[model samples]
Target: MRALSYFFVIFAIFLAPLGVAVARHLADDTQATDWRTARRDSTGIAPLPAQTPEAVIHVYAARAFRWRGAFGVHTWIAAKPQGADAYTRFEVVGWGVSQGRNAVRVGEGVPDGYWYGNAPTLIRALRGGDEVDALIERLRAAATAYPHQHEYRVWPGPNSNTFIAYLGRAVPELHLDLPPTAIGKDYLPDTGVFARAPSGGGFQVSLAGLLGVTLAAEEGLEINLLGLSLGLDLSPPALKLPGVGRIGMSEE
Candidate 1:
């Protein structure tokens, strides 16, 4: 018991600083990301990107559970270019079986599940009138400067590197979490792009079990039935983008 307590203390001390640094870094990078005024193209469809050559999408989801098989809300995200055929997908699936119910699994078949950058954050910033190219550049610069921080890694790694992170140097808005923790491992994609799950249980039992216990401790584990899937199509940029706009936000 004493040893475990010591381990946690040390873990928090070391992890807290690292988490804060990552969070701050992400915040700075996100602030520098460009936000574009997405418009309906000639086809009346607003594709993912309007000016960039390659576009990306982002998806994320998480759930918690309790002993009797209670679960938390499932979440997801989709980020795609202004005009494209298929969007990347991310999902969260439960893995354990209870009362004949299946286990919990997450981050599959949702858009941009492979992308590290936050699509909603980027899009919101763009809608708020940030420059897209500059955002990309800042993200790229951050990517280059940091090269280690990722959405899902115990330490610095590209395990979570996704196509979204490769967006021609455009940075995405950092979803706010002051002290960022390592993104859980499974959601971490293997490469620049994400592929659909071939088969098998989605969430590994260890992580799922940990998450279930943690959430159950907090919220008493409520059973939730949340099913979400997003489909996106990007055609092509109808409007030309202006020279990189100046992001006026003050940096910390």
Candidate 2:
């Protein structure tokens, strides 16, 4: 009886936020459209490359398509080199991996475009001159070096979040603080239970992205269980819940 009670407590602690996430997802009217015909238009969030004429980098996250939005988000990166006419977008997608297609996609799209029908939230941005341009070059190299280019797993894996996490580690200058709703961000390929946090602010230990603890200057403290994260942020004070994401202070 004691063990059963303990299990129930643990389940509630981890799953309560997921329940809230489901409720919120159901209440969102934006998901009503079918994916094939869903809106992928730009939100006019990123600056126009031609007008800016300087190096720029952006990281964006949006709720995943369909029911997955109730659990986590999909993340991607975009950059424009100094004086470049267009922006380059980088992301890992699982669209055709089963048939031997590469999961990493490097293509041109609206830098801040919607994912399917979901409007994206900007996670980070860096705009500058030569320094930012240098970072963009390194970011391109990191995307090419991602080890899981041909592999993908929707849960606890080397999926889209994992790809962004890799880029964060590879280019620590980004200082990315991925939201807890990024289900696969804890996955560390070849690192084996220990690695630098995705933000490069501290360190973390994760077991196949299933279970872990993160202690970071930027991320605060996070606990990962079964691909769901729960934690607290001290700087601006926030509660990080599994699917509901951070509640309290806004990210800097």
User: Which candidate should be chosen as best, given TM-score against the real structure?
Assistant: 2
Off by over 4 Å in 1: 1-126, 130-132, 145-158, 161-175, 178-252
What clash pairs does model 2 have?
none
How many backbone clashes does every candidate have?
46, 0
Task: Report the Cα lDDT for candidate 2.
Answer: 0.91
lDDT per residue as tens, model 1, 1-252 = 999999688445434434544444444433312214322122212233445345443323221111110111123333343344554332222222324432222222333221222222122223212343334345434444432232322122222222222221123243211001212221323332231210111111122211211111111211111110111111111111111111223212
- Per-residue lDDT of 136 in model 1: 36
**Candidates' TM-scores?**
0.24, 0.96
* lDDT tens per residue, model 2, 1-252: 999999799879999989999999999886946878988889999999779998889999999999999999999998998998888999999999999999999878789988998999999999999999999888889888898889999999889999999899899999899999999999888657889999977999999999899999889999999999999988779999999999998777
Query: Distance from true position, residue 18, model 2, in Å?
Result: 0.6
- The 10-residue segment of model 1 with minimum total lDDT is 224-233
Q: Candidate 2: misplaced stretches above 4 Å?
A: 1-7
